[model samples]
Target: MEVDELDFLASSTLYRRKDFLETDEAAKSHPNRNYYYRKNADVDRLIEACTTKLKNNNDNTRALFIRASSYVKKGQLEEAIADYSKLLLVTPDDIDALYQRGTTYEKVGNVDSAIADFTTVLQLNPNHVKAAYARGACQNLKGDFIEAIEDYTVALERDSQRSVSSPKFHARKKDLQSAQAYGGNTSGVPQDAAKDNLGTVERGMSGLSLERQDSMLGQAGSSAAELRDSNGHFAAGSSAAEPRDITGTSASAPGASDPQGAEFYHARGFAHRKRNDYRAAIQDYTRAIELDPKHFKALFNRGFSHDKIGEYELAIKDYTQSLEVDPRNGYAFYNRGITHDRKGDYHKAVDDFSRAIEIDPKNADFYHNRGFSHRKKGNFSLAVSDYTTAIQLNPSHCRAYYNRAFSYDRMQKYHEAVADYTKALEIEPDNATAFHNRGSLYERIGRLQEALSDFGKAIELDPRSALSFNARGLLLERLGRIDEAASDFNRALSLEPNSATFLRNRGLCHRNRGSYQEAVRDFGQVLAQSPKDFATLSNRGYAHRKLGNYSEAIHDYGMAINLSPDSVRLYNNRGYCHAKLGRYADAIGDYSKVLELDPNNIHAHHNRGISSDKMGEFERAIKDFTAVLKLDPYNANAYFNRGSAYDSLGDFDKAILDYTRALDLDMAQGGDGSSQNAKQM
Candidate 1:
């Protein structure tokens, strides 16, 4: 099977000519049209001729090989393999026959058999490039990663040697040296092989493609499509002392005259990429592009390498260039969107993702990534819609459910959020973020025990998650497990020493445990970092008040009030601090402000009543207390306080009536009639 005959076997052999009608009147009537037909021998006649040649000489190796190649071209792998086997019996040590048979086995998905044949070829000729490369691909298909890597290494070393020693390479090197005017120092310019961090798991936060499970051999060199003839015949080439093109086509043949050819550089670049030497790979891709600027695969793979190194902008440029050359490349758009998302240009990411979705409407990845971008932009409703479509397309898409749950959480749809998180867990049971987020949702809905269980599971799955520990600690504190909560908080703080949320949560636990000074210390640390943190300031004020540091407590409350003037609680707290310091007028003013903001605030009314009473304003105190009694009809404290105010004004009769009502209310509530102020009066 010579190349020309093989090429002809892969093309049409029949010829045709149009037949014309000879009626003069008809031809004159239809002058613009011609009606003629002619034909040559049938295409099957060519196949018949090849079969006749085989029938005449059944032992002819070329006839057997050509017939086998034709069978392969017609997708008859069994017949092709059989023919190759028969040819192999005649010439038992034929490398080409063995290589072709191996490739045929691969086409039929009999990878183990393919590997055996390739192994036999390597044993016969250890330096056989095609056999080694084919064997590596088979090993990779079989999930034998280590063996695949060894074969690829051998092929790459041979390829590199072949490239360096070629006469064309030396001439090109000299030309480069002359062009750059670098003198003769190009002799030993050391180039470092890039480190292989490609094995590191990607976060996939922006939906970038993650590391593939198989070894990287598949990314190198021509794919199966490029290796086959036009008629689908796979002609495996044998190398001479100088390497030949693996596809067995003279058009792609490597030679001394074409040192800077795109095919040569693309093969080398792919080899370097497989080894995770991305820097070296990029250089080769650049040279390939310099030779053939429209090389889309080289540009895309170079972008992928740049993305691995976190060079997002460079990756985007390469992807854009690749897309310009091949506008229908949806994957280029998808990856470019990922880079945009990583760069926090979420609007641009959305546009690119939309383009990808338009190009590849059935791809679930496009919808999922678009959903992620929508989520980042806080467009929760749009995010949920995209995620829903993705889930419908791929029922097992765990990340889609997880992200949808997050969007639900943002919308405060706790029940929906919990359901989505549960779905995500059903798909990926060990997803720690799903557990953590679900736990938080459970806690929000007051499912304390379930929240605790989820938090524990999250911690078990991801032991180093500081946020999980903090969440569990807060729940424990709420459940009155103060000692356990403190331990968890300590661990959380150790993991993330500067988290203000953790500090505030721990401080609350301390306050609940009556560790006032320790509570102050934690709150103070948070306040030091965020001086205008009203919540922390107010928390520290409460701690100070517990310690009876009235002045300090008052100052903290005033500072908190300045930061949040509209906060009802801050005003109430400041009022209490004023009352503690016997600043009755200031306390009354603070309470008035609280009342102005919330006119029906019962606590504010009661506190202001006390402040007025302290200043001997009995009439105003009685009115405020009366209002509290009206709002809360069974408020015994309010009745008793009003009674006391009446007594102070020497209205003993009304005071006695109010006190009687207070006693009646307390007895109705099954009380022992223990009214402190009433008894004092």
Candidate 2:
């Protein structure tokens, strides 16, 4: 194509200086031309010169470079790439060519190739600011903020004199703020890998960016009054005076007597916060507040720093002060609400979150946080309403959807919960928590296959998620995959050695497999971690009873009953243990307690009768047996026990009548009428 155009141009007189440089007189006579004909003539001349040169010597690298630059200026990126490619074939080590090609690739929207070319340019000249900035932009687009920040930092360090006015500095600062907010992972995962940690890390860790926080707090009167730093000391304005130490304040401190000094401290605090040094940030912000009591930004930023360090009371105080300084600070209220929620004061949290919503009615975070407080207070219906509002405000809010699902789960609305979880997963396909929780909901609704699939996906997405492993183990156990369940439980235990829940679940699996000794060992480990756990004590007692260790079983059951004195089931278990150990009187006492708590307990009545007969209390035995017969007319054992009691008391006639009724019931129940008790009667 280039050869043909060059041949035609060489043959035509259009390339003549007179014909090409001068505009046609006739066309010039016309009006409404958007561009000058002379400019078009010049472009034609440049193209003609390059093409003519290239056609004469097909290996002319200079002509190819000129033509590629012209094509780039004309928005013909593909033609430019071809020309640059030809030039690079001749001079592969040309840094300028690589850089120009990289920028052309960016214009053509081929970010990977652009990044590659820019990286090559950097390799040739490590201090190439344009290459660093261009590569950083590409990395940001690929969601590799950590690497982008590194590139931007290098560029900033290499060009610090231009840092204040450069867009690279501001872009780097913004990305750093966001990376800190989301806990930027430094583990070097692939740039294009699917993200599984979307919104799963800590929130509110980002407060401000040092160089670009003017929108949050309006700037001072003059450019010279902007926050400035020398060495590690921060100050405001052109004051060459030394910075006052944050450890102890002085009248000549950075924030002293200057309206913009508080901003200086605030900016420095943000720098500290970016390094995760919340304590130092708090000191800076506190100094800022001391300089200007009504500095709302400083007050709010201090509160955030305090919250980061788990000093909820101090955080609340700072937020309250900030609100007092600026009565319309919705963020102050919202942050205070979060602090209250962390402190377990749900009512206060709800009130503050409600106020925040009233001030900033359109913020989805306000509604979502309020809903979280409601859920904590067990108000599931209100939680659902808030979460719905949050979703309506921002339909793609996956965290809101996830929280709403939990609220639905608490209300026993399994279908609604499952749908919400599914919606969350739709918005964020790699949300492992959503997958794990939805699997639980599926299991609750008896969708076992769906539950299995979700659990499997959750484990795949987050291989180290102990909760997912434990939950899958429980589902597998329910499906009778005992070995698989045990394996998962072992994995979970290996990950979280002190997880009592995992220990208890594994113990239950052991009991189900009839490995009483192993079950006892696991339950004992759980008890060691949580000595007062009633369920673990009861489970261990059952294992001991299965192994015929009646004394140990009775002791465990006694401890469990002490923890939950009104538990009728605990009393029954203890009664059985006592009876197995030939402690008839103790067994009778436990059964009587069970009957006292539950007047219509048929099992308690029958067990008490058996204990009475064992203790030679014929009258009490007969009474209990009569009560059992009254409750269950077909109770053959009750009639037989009563006949034995009568015989023991020498009432032969009554004993014979009871014996006859017992024999008839035995025949009706498919039992052979050949009992030693009846024959003796």
Off by over 4 Å in 1: 1-284, 305-313, 343-351, 377-382, 408-419, 443-448, 478-483, 578-681
Q: lDDT for model 1, on a 0 to 1 scale?
A: 0.68
Question: Candidate 1 on 417-506: residue-level lDDT in tens?
Answer: 899989978987886767877887788798989989998998899888776787788788778899999989898889988977678778
Each model's lDDT comes to 0.68, 0.68
Best model number under TM-score: 1
Task: Report per-prediction Cα RMSD to one decimal.
Answer: 15.0, 17.2
RMSD of 1: 15.0
> What is the Cα-based lDDT of residue 323 in candidate 2?
77
lDDT of 2 by residue, 457-518 (tens): 98899898776777788888889999899898888889878877778888888898898999
Leading candidate by lDDT: 1
